[model samples]
Target: MKFTSLLKAATTVAFASVLIACGNSSSSSSSVTEVEFFSQKPEMQATLQEIVDDYNKSQDEVKVKLTSVPDAGTVLKTRIANGEAPDVINIYPQNADFKGWAADGQFVDLTDESDILGNLNEGAAEAYAVDSKIYNVPLTTNVSGIYYNKDAFDKLGIEVPKSLAEFQDIVKKIKDDGQTPFAEALGDPWTVNGFAQLAWIQSASSPQAANDYLRFSDKGAIKSDEVSKNVAAYLDLLAGNGQSNSDGALYADTVAVFSEGKALMMANGSWALTVIKQQKPDFEVGFFPMPGLTADAPTMTVGAADMAVSISAESKNVDASKDFVKYLSSTEAMQKYYDVDGSPTSVKGIDTEGKFEELADVADLAFTDQQAIWLHSEWTSEEIFWDVNVSYIKNKDLTAYTDALNTFFDTMK
Candidate 1:
């Protein structure tokens, strides 16, 4: 798989080298317009370089040099402050810093980039829009959920559970059969945050409750019995049946452990499929939206645009940067990205029929249902929620979590 293969290739290249080679400033003889493309996702370094190579080879008018750095938000902010911002940047909308950046007009207003943005998924594009003006065009989008091993389920005579009790039964069965029920990498806050987001969504009593979690401004916002119970249930699942070393496991460990069949399930997104396929090519996998808290309340999905391409408002070469961003939105670029990234594209009319063969019914349900929730919208500062979620996972202390959330909410308001 491109994800695994390219990542391996990326390791051989020094990070400092990649950062130094930001653009084609050294090539004085080259007449092409050189656009510096910056991205925060280190995993996509080699894959993005491939995308840029393909684009440069396809045309001569402009050249894109890819610079993938760490700590995306901090790096981007520093670059902007230093007046050395990349010409085109890949933005992750889920980052809390993006809200400030959008408001500050960091990126060029893309509302008028009709040719590039016209065929995009309207819901996703609208998510990136501020004041009816969009500054970024989504590159790829994915849904977060429980990714499970289908072969293990079939071997154990387990079917997809419709209710939370049934799901817990399957988890217990997996554990009884000498298998790890879940691949939990607690070292990464985002993984636990994903689970926390699902729990909050499943605990919601109404659609309004699910959508507007941030509106609960009271001190008891996170102290409700229902939410505390759900949080406890989630912690019990991880602590009781997760992989042996899951307490200290990292993101790479989760991918390796889950892919190698050491675990039966992973709470993750559609992107894990490719890497898992790469590790165990014949392994069968399936996905389900996080099961609801009880039978009466079934699970619903929350999705947001994971990646988007935007041009720096301060770019010296606006037209060149626009060209690169436009290329990123084209069908060819999207197809290649979807193939490697293993996520659904937001571009309309792009055929993704067998693209998600690993996920059969789960794919259908995600696309057909329109109840898309931006999970991050539940909190004013996502970093605070991440910390609270990690603490909850570590201790299952609902009272402390609630107090922290209330304090954070008070600051936000």
Candidate 2:
């Protein structure tokens, strides 16, 4: 027999034997189909495991074992190449790599799975959709906005600024008071790139401008008056008012600096909330949209489903894997996962109230008028982002940076 035929026959026999055992068994314990679940975010490991444990207890037919890795993208890709990918994989939809996998038929087509598809926020789910097919289900979402030290604002008699002008004034006052205005984690170019994304979103004149900002080729694309000027201005302000060592500090160090009351504000996302609280539980905090051209520029913010869950196309136990996926995508399970993980859910009509004020402040905007694409997730190469943004930061030259960006994407085209 051909190798493919032999493999298919063996898989069928194994699946049939497991079904037979499950059908015939009458004991308290029966044969359990195990699915290997691989998670990319180390921070969510414990929460994921708890959810997995609940799913296991709810049903005896399938058991899911989750393994969390810090470098999830690299590890997951290597596993897939080796024909050893996990049965259930948790990854970020923002990642361009996911598109490659989806196009290559590595993921099970979940378009018809209404139980999973119906519960999702349509826009959020669309981020991971390829050719109108839902390849993965969203797990939870994160908000990106400005995190401010409420205590610092109170002590300095500074109300939360409402406009870009007001925000700049506050930064100036904070600086005049001998405090760093923004605790930038520039040691990690990715974190710096986060600021770029925030700037691009806040400065966008409209959703069209924001969406088109990522297109590297159109004539005068990156240099458009609203997007480029505002982004450059924001970076310039950060460079001037940030920590003395802001350019040298890693993301963790910025967290520490903010927690210790050394900086009054930090440009971060909801993902950093847990670490900040853990670093200093009583470090009073609040959030607001990135103040646009005026305090009135729509008060836009960036947010989306952070990670997604998908089943492998080549799994031996597709039925069991779907069961596990369904459990994770449920409202109850996702809420538990988010409660422990401290991120808002990507599912519509799910109650995320009173979870984090940072999330609550932008709840209306995150779901409505101010959605922004996470360029980091869409950018095909990290090298392009790091090189362009980092160089911009060091030289403070917008033209050079835009030129380099176009040059890179031009090569890809």
Candidate 3:
């Protein structure tokens, strides 16, 4: 519970010394099963370890050790490459790496894990479903949107817009008021990448609308369509409306600018709110889903599976890993994670009423199955797609979008 326990997961110990459980449900009466859980979520490391500690103390049958390191993606790839897959892992199901590993049977097939999947709020698990089958245990869900400064909006007498046109008008109104419209940090490709994805999601239709359009529509949709063109135009509008010299601003700089009340809005995921909160700005910050084509459609939140854990299919200790994963599904464990992280719980019964009020509006979209899993997660190479969007944002060229759709066909479809 102290600051020191946060380092519990940052160990370099190999799995060679641990007692691996037999694959079957039953283990030797005298021996305790040792299970490895490699995690990439640094923020939740200690929380996970605390849960592990509780689980370990509750029983002597299996011990779950959390393994985390700096540069976890590379470490995980190397471990799996060397046939040292952790028995359990925390992975984002929407990422390309998760897709590849799931396809290759790196994780256990949880299609029949009704005891686990059934506990989650509807679509929380399905949003990240790999080929309609569940491979990861969805715990907490995160949503993306525009975080607006309440004081700034109040000063300008601005109301939250419910349509794309209205949203554009707000941008113009902010600009006309001689204030910055957005804190877009183009210097950080990921920020631009987030804005691009959110634009496409809100512009196309709504949650599933964006999901299907990107995955099943014509590959040329980005090349020739009102929707695609409108999205591109909006991206152009956003690129031009950012804070002063925003193209060179770092992600931290945007947080600072937005926190200082110099910028009206910031396009980012739910995680950014944490950083903004730390700065203790005078005004209240609120979040709303990116505006869609119409008022009713304005609440589409773009996000994905957050803090999802899965078991390795190739593990020698399947039973032990299952035991650990089952423990994670308990209402107590999920609630512990939800309480500390302030993230919306994917589990069915944890009440999030009045918590994280800044996230209230978008949280509705998140739990009600309204979040569109990040489209890049479905791509063959999401980074390359992100690079294309970044290219468009910087050069303000439409052809970069053509390259994006080409990536959709070449790597995604």
Candidate 4:
């Protein structure tokens, strides 16, 4: 919500200023060139500002102006098409549909820049690469897990559930005892998608399974039985009488429910920790991996770089932009960013204890030799996947859902 609000505010400011500046502009080349950074999260602007301040202090050649745009992917596309695009942009590779953009040569390839590419996490580097060409440099990585109210679990004598069946049983018991089992924000697209993503991962055990379901590839088989069954089970749990929020509460409301201690458990990515801690410092909170669907199935969590900074293909100050990005990726810069934002650093071996202790255990599990995958929306057309998921959840029509998914894949061509 902070991010959304920030984007709207930024757009209003950009629009008003653009109108006024157009009247006074005589020679645009003489003034400080602004490197507009379109970003979704308002909080990220603070981290970027830190880097910009440092960059500006050290050099007089270029001035980097960052603008927070809501729905950055859409904004970037529209601006680029209108020939008013920025020189540098910050976006989630998944949300920005970086792969498709790269295929169309809309983004500048940074594959040859080993200095920037080498500093990123392996998974992040791979995600930022399309057709073996790197287009973006990751700023931070976020992972998803179950956040529980420590006091509630302790009082209920409930250990963190380790398997899906156990988790559902715990939820049912909690409900039977007149307490909400889980807090979900269906209104917030991310919150609804968060649960859908968890279910997708649980149903699709292997990496290949994820690729098949998410990418809609014809090569991989769809475990429709597993996926459909899990979807029904998860929805049944959410739609049960014990949910704290109203029947169709959005994601923000769901988060508020958990932060206010109305629910025992809420599924969210690491970013929620900041808001939770800020709002409920006295509340004891802990996290665990989303329980595995099968005992032997290795646990997999949703993860991706929080933001990737890329040089715009139309950038006039490419060298300065690259320098700025390089500095942003340095160990010192990343440490500061992580400290300020509670974000997990992309640089390997950076100590996280002081800033992100809540995530220490989960982060350890994530970095283990076990494999992980990005969220489904990250690899597919977000509009199609998100719409199909919401429809399936609300309607529970398996045939229609699967057919729509197959049609989505056909459209990808």
Best by TM-score: 3
Query: In each prediction, how many residue pairs overlap at the backbone (N, C-alpha, C within less than 3 A)?
Result: 0, 1, 0, 4
Q: Order of all candidates by lDDT, from best down to worst?
A: 3, 2, 1, 4
lDDT of 2 by residue, 1-413 (tens): 69999999999999999988877775434568889999877877887889889999998789888888767788889999988889988876667778888888998998888777777776667666887888888767677777788878898899876777887788889988988888777777776655677677777675456546665446444553556777777777676666788778898998888888888888878788888888864667887777777855677677666767888998988889888887787887888776777666666565667776655675456545575657556556756676577667778887897777667655544
Best by lDDT: 3
Q: Candidate 1: lDDT of 311?
A: 84
Write down the TM-score for model 2. Answer: 0.85
TM-score of each: 0.81, 0.85, 0.86, 0.80
Each model's C-alpha lDDT?
A: 0.73, 0.75, 0.78, 0.69
* Candidate 3 residue spans exceeding 4 A from truth: 1-29, 206-221, 367-369, 399-413
Give the poorly placed runs of model 1, Cα more than 4 Å off. 1-31, 70-72, 205-211, 214-216, 294-298, 360-374, 377-380, 394-397
Name the better of 2 and 3 by TM-score: 3
lDDT of 3 by residue, 1-413 (tens): 66556555433232322424332324454578889988888888999899999999999889888898999989888888898888998888878888888988888998888777877766667766787888998887688888999888988899988887888889989989898888877777777666677777766765456656776656655465777777786686676788777878888999999999888898888888789989988899998777766777646777776888989888989988888888897888888888778776788777677778898888777756466777767555555556676667667777667766666664455
The worst-scoring run of ten residues by lDDT in candidate 4 lies at 366-375
